[model samples]
Target chain A: MSPYDLLPRFKAQYDANNQEFSISGVVRPQAIDELGPSIALLRDAIGRVRGVLYVNVRRLTQMNNAAFHAFSRIIIDACRARPDLKFVVITSSVVGWTSRKFGRLSGIEPNITVEEYDSEFYPGQGFLEEGGFVPILRSQTKMTWRHERAILPRHGMRQGIVMADICCGIGDFAVLVQKEFQPSRIVALDHSISSLNYARQVMREFDIRGIEYTYGDASEMLLDEAQFDLVTCRHSLQIFNRPELILKELYRICKPGGRVYITNEKNSHCLGEPRAESIRWTYNEVAKLFGHFEMDVELGPKSRRYLMEAGFEDIRVETFMVTNLDGDPQDFADVIAAWADVYAGEMATRRGDGAEFVARFRQGFQDHIFAALHPKGYAGWPIWVASGRRPQ
Target chain B: MGPVQHDLAGEPTFEPMIQIDMEIKGFVSAWRHCDYVSTYMARMISQNRSDSVRHSNLFSSAFNELLEVAFRTRHADGELACRVSRHGATDRIELTFPCVPEERQFYEEAVSQVAGTEARERYLNSVSGDLAPSREIVLLELAVDYNATLRVEEADGDVIRLVVDLPLEGLQH
Candidate 1:
């Protein structure tokens, strides 16, 4: 069958001027035999065309192997029909389905070219729902303590040292850092005045003095340059529209011999059977919903490289797993549920399929609760804290 | 009923069809039902003998792989029509789903890319288990001999259908 017959199935469009074709939507199992005939009819149409023949799959939400192999055949056939054809498979990193790394059949006559590209149809709105999340985050100090143990600097908080924390939401980790390090001046900054006020309330409730709250852009802070003894940002850099700008600002503000610290959650792993694996699967899939963003939050080992690019010295990266081992599993459940509740509202406004997502998030959150119980221990979604000294 | 015909693998085959339209979970559920029913029917045909169990397992595995793909990439909109028929002793199952034009184009190309060589080895190793299963993967894992075909066809109402054909009789050695 002519490959063009499949055009309606893929919503593909061909532009004769550029000799380019682009397709979008979920690739089903039977894409080939369906489209092949229609495309075969195009051999004459393409054979007469000039320059490179570019086929773009970057818009696809996902593709299965059977479908991919099928599509590959149509391309090879077209190339054979038109030896001058230069087929380029444009790929995207938005979803896990499109592999940035693809394969080549060593001796294929017409070598098809593969190009990397990205088109973000929807940006993640989860960060805007921080209000529902921060309260739960505030109550999860046990997690903070666990992460701090692995990430905290070896030396205790030196006296008379000033520290700056960017995007310091509710100051959970900032308070812990100040308590342990006993830094003389703790400047906690966030874009949200409400979040800063909440952090202040936490400080007052604990009688933990030393942290000074500031409401402003964490990326473009008003703080003087090269002043603070230590500059820190945890779990929020990934949400920033431009992380490189903030990273540069973090480096710019730190005192030359001082250190800069940043941390993020890498991924989640399950130890139990089907239930654990199921939750992990659901969680990982949901995480992909947030992957269309320009910058990634889960830097993991890559954080060290980012730090190095920022011209930091003596970079050290440590991974801390927040298993919530010591905390009540209910705490994890409550947090995830609240997290979903918060996300549901904002996401509804951003996505056309927002309602479906809201339902999935709620269901996934509930499944996570069930999985959390009787857990022999879950690992991963590792929180990485990478630190580096600003070169003297 | 026509006279019984045996294939080289010594297993009988039949053709049947089914349809589906769902988001991820619903699709998965529908597929689970399909897997259970299809394998059960196969067992009845093969007569639950000692060797039949092995064939049943292979059937379920291949079917499960196809279901995984549908779960991952199949859109919630439109109906998915599945048909299973006999090719010699093999059951040639064909699944058709509504899709967009570009998607149809993409799959045609993907099929061509893995035409010859060690397609199964490269495919199985490259794909992360986290996503949908590939039909080819099911056959490869079972070490079975099968020929798979995927194509797009025009349906009524200007809708396009993606049709996948998998010929399965039983595991080879």
Candidate 2:
């Protein structure tokens, strides 16, 4: 048996067609001899590939000195041996160490280059994680929290349980959970550095303790299995192209018999008075707009099927509407205004929608905002809440 | 995020966080001990950081290097104590383990070399060199890559204490 088989925490794979060799997981072998199988695999990959050989370590969580030295030697030696071939080492910003460590190779050998793998995993991440969108996120959370604060208890949230808020955008929900539920421990993780930084700043300002705001890819988190008693991923599934992968990860981290909670929106269900037809037309377009980006904004009703397919048991699902009546009317209006800016302004423009289509799309959101702020009018945004237990 | 309130001495002081005391023999017996101890201590202390997971990963990697060095160099029969303390953005990891004369000299020289002007050059060479990985590579990493302050001194009798002050969270770009 190979040394890697003995220590299964590490995995190495090579795709010959792409000429890419990817390494993932923790690699902390005590001696360089133990890395023989991996090094051999890399050597073989190098011989077979031409042009550029991509060494991808976007998911490598840990690498000790012994492993680093061994890997560096192979790259440095290969660069000298194959002067015609270019080597690009792909690292992840989320992993924190791989970029700096592997980046040293680019300085040593001109043939070797280092590239931090950007957010190719989430197609819509850029539009959502921008600095201008942060306030909208906070307002959206504030609007949803009013309904969720009451609904969470029915879905297995309680004080003193260990919890994690995956894809915890700006961490407003985490702070609310910390204050309301008082989880003994809360690890709020997100892929956005600016969002995590903002979360940390808010924590320090409020002097709130116990929430660990961490940077990570929710699809493949480094957290140990079965560690959290309750794992909450709210209103984030619809943002990802492949949410089933995220649900699989949520299932992995959640403890057996523990619950994984999620909330998502079905944009077409959005309703408003005094311009109901325009609002409905625009929301249906909103769903299609998100679909153009490979996102499923209509994923709310599908949560139960996703949960069941992910092997979760005891699934419970509920729907709630965030209306202007829930809170200050202006807050709801602000959310609609921001959505108009993003969905119609940025997303629609990016999708190559013409001036006429953009005007109609923008009109729907404006009408929603108008309905929200009008003295006698009403606007409502529907959200689906679902939770499933990891089978014991 | 808040205004700086300096102490009368104008030097920031460390507040004790957490520590682990174990027998050197037991620690050195298994390689996994280094991984477990570093990961646990890192998780416990990184809760309040700007990015706890990133901090924990960085802290664990650096701390594990120290623990591995101690595991390789320590005397077989003595107490091994690992303590982590923090002051503002800086985290200090102090590792106390029993060592013989040669082991003590090895660490002292490594610490001195890390303090030299040519430390980064030496580190790059050591890590990239075709020879077997140098034992001092860990110290060089903590010094050059992490910009950590390294200090070593003789403790009780045969014990040597290695202190590494790492402002890891603050150093993130």
Candidate 3:
């Protein structure tokens, strides 16, 4: 018997009092055959609730289609019974919304509400649990950072210029543009099939027309160069092992006088130590790439420097300081863990204690680098944004 | 029996009950500015269930508090009224309100102002002094229905609250 069988207890408690209910249990995959039974039990549990059911589906990094189907059947059945039941579904990370089948599953039921909870939901670096923080952060960030910063500024009527969003994760920027700008055409490109599927689903739900979602490597995609009026590479630049090649592609695709906005997380180089050397190396490599192109550049103090070095002209850089100490200690710990995981490959071969060494060094980095550096007791990363125009 | 309190029980006189409920529901649904009102209401209604009459009174009071805090803050002339009546073992709360023609016109105008052009541009300029240079104004038009109801059914001591006729509309102004 799987832990999903325990859901009946939760259902009974919920029915008896209608109190806000929470179920915490571990799911072990016994075999390929056992997966179906486990999913059935979980679905049965979900069907018992009539009110708002917030399903936190975690440990889904290894979930396959059969597992997803099982989960979807349960959700579909629940929605069919009580259309008013609002289902809030959370996933670890969503790769593509426009191309993935599961991403489109939210559209299967009008009553089921699905949203991707990524870095925006966390206070600083914490994974948000139920009743922990506000659920609106994901929506707010999309409006502020993705919409206000990228989409709203560039949309217009009768403009021949089209937009190509490289690595359009979950179609946040793409959806905002399609809905707000009503652009002549938009090509949303992402590497993950799942993210593309979700993006497509959102577009369908919003009834947004004339947007195309493509699933392929943004760098290798056979797109016509100089066809786009604007090329946006939001938060996807650094992930490329060879960012220089990607920059070359961006330059080739952008029309003369067209603009490119690149945003990334700035590694802490303020520590003035071995960790600082690694940060400096990363920035230098990025700068060398931009030097090849004849464009003006602006360098932000944080992650915004890479755009300046990429030969972008009339560059603007903005620095955003975010702290991750708003919630419990465990939340901060989780953030540290995630940070370590993200940079583990790079941090492992370096010197001592891996990320912990870098983290500890960051604590005293300001004192060594800048006399004016304020030493506020907090744990968070600083993000930098840089935008530049290609010369005509 | 003395005054019959404006009795037109069967006259079918445009009982603003559905209209009022719909207006409140519309206001709540139109703007995705808050959480689900039914969920919040259910919690409040369940906690205040001391007796049938007291439960109704408390439900009415709590519902009004939610109305004032959530909907009244946005509109200047917003009105909310609630009446509790017992039908045998079950109790129903009916909310009513007088129609405000000016406010309705104001909303229609506001929607039109942001219709063709970027809606966010107009909204930002109206609300905040700073103008964002971006022309892309993604405006999700608030969905407002003129008739709706929130039914709370009690079966076997389990209270199931359902928000009916919740009109969902998407507008890009």
Candidate 4:
């Protein structure tokens, strides 16, 4: 009789190296009840044979609070006895809407890991399981430090240019444009109300007004034709499923001589630091699952050509090698870890090897942090700032 | 009952029932040129204090056409009464017309006889081109939901009741 008899649809097995253990399929509380003790015994024995145990639960269909707590206790207690051994829980949220929105889970020690991967791989440094990775990725005060600073100074964001920002993620870049550039008026549109709510909070924090924020599809804007003086999307263009339709829409809305400023990464380099390499490797795999809407990820690298294809004149592309190490190396790791987890859950549903790959890849992120803190730790991240002008 | 929704910062949320009951005095009052009664009702339904953007936008669209139908019919006097209420958290726009008693059968037939899928599709394809959507197509399209209806509930005199109960499920964001 198979150990997962009660959970006929599920499978729990060890990999070739035993460094990674995977439990996949409908992982309900009753199923966990049947399999929990054997898994706990395996967790206890894991420390004796291997220095690490990567628990890939990314493919679980449903895990209730009690089952999650029970499994968490097993890992936390086992890791408690063997301080040198590490236990990392890699999960995917793509199973369903309610899946993977789990509360933070960790072993008693600080080094134990529980990573919830978001499908959209926004930028981040790695994370330490100890603090449960609640790092604020967006900051209004320190807005100028990242990619936007490279494109800001040149433009005359005069008092009369009606601007529109599509996919204004959390409105961080839009706020910067409104404050620094000072356009006459801006209409920010995004599909997600939750994100816009956060953006509205940020606007209140700045005490600024006159921006019209609404829920709209970027490709099919509800606004009148050629109404905007400028249109900008930062770190958001690559995520659209129908970029061609949207790019054409952007072209249609731009006023003569007005520009469309779009920014996203063509290359994400972490100074060849071992840790940075690990995060990027994991990021690339996770991004493959949900990031594309029916488009290629190659679009980010070839945005200049896409602009030309979208029929924009006087297209200009700028590559800025943004280099900074002001933050702690561990903080960098934590941020990257946070970013890595963004898609693990979402991707698990796409591939048969998803849970296993997510765990192995996260271990790579852990190794990157350990190596990045070395004396030679350094990283260089790149931002491709592409702009095109509507014909005069 | 309207879908409960949170509001923008500083903007207040909507009550389950609107405090002020709105009355559209006459069919001519709404359809006579482009005037207050239509605009008033549109604003009330569109800017539902509830802040349910999807519900407000979609419901207002269907009601505008329905209100237009209320007038264009023959017996329509300027005398009309409309109450926007919620059915236990369900958002519905209820309009009662003191229609010309003679043409009551016409409005009744229009509501009772709905076009089928092919007829509805043909109706849509016909009037889809220009901004003009025919009365038949509009009524048929609204009936697809099965919630929107026109029924002649003859009481003291003969009065036509037009109820558009917008399903929150169909209102996809």
Task: Pick the lDDT winner.
Answer: 2
lDDT of 2 by residue, A1-392 (tens): 54634657888899988899998888888877878889999999988998999999987999998888888888888888889899999988787777878887888888989998755667878888874888888889998989899999998899999999999988999999999989999988888777888888898899889898887888888787899999999878998988998999999999998999999999999999979999999999999999999999999999999999999999999999999999899999988998888898889988999999999989999899889988999999999999999999
Computed on alpha carbons, the lDDT of every model, listed in order, comes to 0.56, 0.87, 0.42, 0.54
- Where model 3 places Cα greater than 4 Å from the true spot, the runs are A1-161, A269-311, A322-337, A340-380, B1-173
Runs of candidate 1 with Cα error greater than 4 angstroms are A1-131, A155-159, A268-274, A293-295, A354-361, A375-380, B1-173
Q: Which runs in model 4 stand beyond 4 Å of their true positions?
A: A1-146, A153-156, A182-184, A197-208, A267-270, A274-298, A326-331, A343-350, A354-360, A367-376, B1-60, B70-173
lDDT of 3: 0.42
Clashes of each: 70, 0, 31, 36
Model 2 vs. true fold: TM: 0.92
What docking grade applies to model 3?
incorrect
Each model's DockQ score: 0.01, 0.56, 0.02, 0.02
Task: In model 1, state the lDDT of residue B112.
Answer: 51
By TM-score, rank the candidates, best first: 2, 4, 1, 3
Question: What local lDDT does model 4 show for residue A297?
Answer: 39
lDDT of candidate 4 at residue A295, scale 0 to 100: 28
**Which ten-residue region of model 3 chain A has the weakest summed lDDT?**
A121-130
For B7-43, candidate 3 gives per-residue lDDT tens digits of 4366222212211233444564432211224323433
**How high is the TM-score of chain A in model 1?**
0.61
